[model samples]
Target: MTATLMTGTDLAAEMVAKAADRARALQERTGVQPCLATVLVGDDPASATYVRMKQNRSKKAGIGSRSVVLPAETTTEDLVAELTKLSEDPAVHGILLQHPVPAQIDERAAFEAIDPAKDVDGVTTRSFGAMAFGEPGFRSATPGGIMRLLEAYDVPIAGAHAVVIGRSPILGKPVGMLLLASNATVTYTHSRTTDLPAIVRTADIVVAAVGRANFLQGDWLKPGAVVVDAGYNEGNVGDVDFAAAAEVASLITPVPGGVGPMTIALLLEQAVDAAEAQTA
Candidate 1:
């Protein structure tokens, strides 16, 4: 069956509109605006574009945004200090540090510096713990967006055999946990896995987040499986070979128009949520 596409662009637009209303209501009631602060270390063009997209979306949603661009040679301590400052600022409701920081910088340390209360992008230890424990807390934007897209498409998550490829803390690990919380049998695979294709062929839901281009082939998918490609590689290729996978899978999320828009949508939603919680 040619897979029915799960388009994130449409859903993201709806979610963003709701976030805008929420932002307006919060501003009207408490006179406090929801604000997100993005910290960028180094001058990575892709990261810069991602940050700009977020900022532009925030403006449309009525969420204020501030950017802190640091040199590529920034130290971990300096980056952490900047994030901490944003955490402590009453005006800032959320903090996001663009990923793939300089080699010398400790990314996790910088992530931890964002206060749990303002961790709208949800990259901190606290947020992960909350997600793992199924507690009420923010989620990393991309994974959260992936889950929302699945639900929006009415995919049956419970009891599904889900194979999540990759082990990244923010993407694969957390997405697996979220799926487990939804009652899916989750298996996480990495580069070291023996015969990865064999494992993927058994899954009813496949989440490809391994950061490689066309790593998962269409032949690996179980017929009628639900495919979610979360990879954003250079040249706009995803971990899964979308053209091939779509030919077999019953449902699939396309690259660029799939997970990307939903990510910013959730971030804006969480920023508004954080602001409302802070004011309440």
Candidate 2:
């Protein structure tokens, strides 16, 4: 059977449209709109582009967004103060601090400043614990999108062996946690893992988030395995070698069109949900 290409952009657009309808209905009855606050440090081109795309999508979905852009020289204490201020703002329903803050800034401290209820980006330790425990809390956007994609396509998670290649707090670890929540046995690998290809070959579901270009080869995938490529390297290439994996796998997510758009979509969705909860 030919591999099914999972287009996250298409799915994300559909989700945003549906969420827009919900937002409108909620606003009509409650006279309240969902709002997201995005904080950015430094001037990384890719981060800036991502933040802009999220803001644009939020607008399209009838959600409000406020952006706080800080300079490269911004101190860690100053960043934490800013995030704390946003967390306390009644008008801000959701808070997202873009990753890769300047080297001098303590990113973890900044993330911890966000209130769990408003941590729609799911970066805080509280959010992580909630996800691990399968509690009622916002999920990391990319992981949430991955699970949504799987459910949308009816990919079985229960009783499956899923191998996640990466261990970053935002993407790799969180995605594995989500899969585990869905009853999938999870094995997490990273750059230091030996026999990486062998580990991937044993997985019924493979998630590549190692940030290395074309790291997962076609021959390494189990035939008919489901592959989700969450890595986006320079020039928009993903971690898995898509052409190769597609030839062997049953289902796969592409680089630019796969997991990227869905991240922003889920962020907007959670932002709307947070807003509704605040107004309720």
Candidate 3:
């Protein structure tokens, strides 16, 4: 049977509309417009595009946007100092640091400098820990989006075997933790994983988070497995061979319209939540 597509575009739009309503209400009650601060370092064209898109979306949702662009050679200390300033800003409710900052900057240290309460993008260590333990806190945007997609589509998560094909701290590891919290058995694999295809075949759900394009083959999936492609490589390609996997899997997510929109939606929603909490 051909797989049914799990399109996230419509669902993401619905979520954004709701967030806009909340943002409007918050502003009316407290005269505090929810605002999201985005930090970008260097001139990576792709990263810049992502930041611009997020900022545009935030404006449409009634959330204010602050753009902070840093030079490529910026040192770790300077980055930390800037983030600390945003964290202390009462007007800024959420802070997001575009990933893959300059190599010289300590990415983890910069992430730590973001206060946990304002970590709307959920890159800080405290956010990660809270998510892993199923505590109430902001979730890494993409993983949080993935879980929302699964729930919206009524994908059975509990008691299922989920194989996450990557080990990146933000995407792969955290998604696995979320699945585990949902009662799904999780197996994490990375580039070093041997017999990768065999492991994937055993999963009831497969999450393709590895950054490579078309890295997962159709033959690697079980006949009815659900596929969630979280990779957006060059040329809008995904980690899974979409055409091939669709022929075997029961459900699949497309690269651009799938996980990407949901991620931005969740980030904006969490930003509104942060604004309400901080004001209350």
Worst 10-residue lDDT window, candidate 1: 117-126
Worst 10 residues of 3 by lDDT: 122-131
Ranking by lDDT: 3, 1, 2
Shift in Å, residue 219, candidate 3: 0.3
In model 1, pairs of residues that clash are none
- Using TM-score as the yardstick, the better of models 1 and 2 is 1
Expressed as tens digits, the lDDT of each residue in 22-133 for candidate 3 is 9999999999999999999999999999999999999999999999999999999999999999999998999999999989999999999999999998888898998899
C-alpha local distance difference test of each model:
0.93, 0.90, 0.96
- Enumerate clash totals for all models, in the order shown: 0, 0, 0
On lDDT, the stronger of 1 and 2 is 1
Candidates in order, TM-scores: namely: 0.99, 0.97, 0.99
Evaluation by lDDT, superior candidate among 2 and 3: 3
Q: What TM-score does structure 1 among the candidates reach?
A: 0.99
Pairs that collide in candidate 3 are none
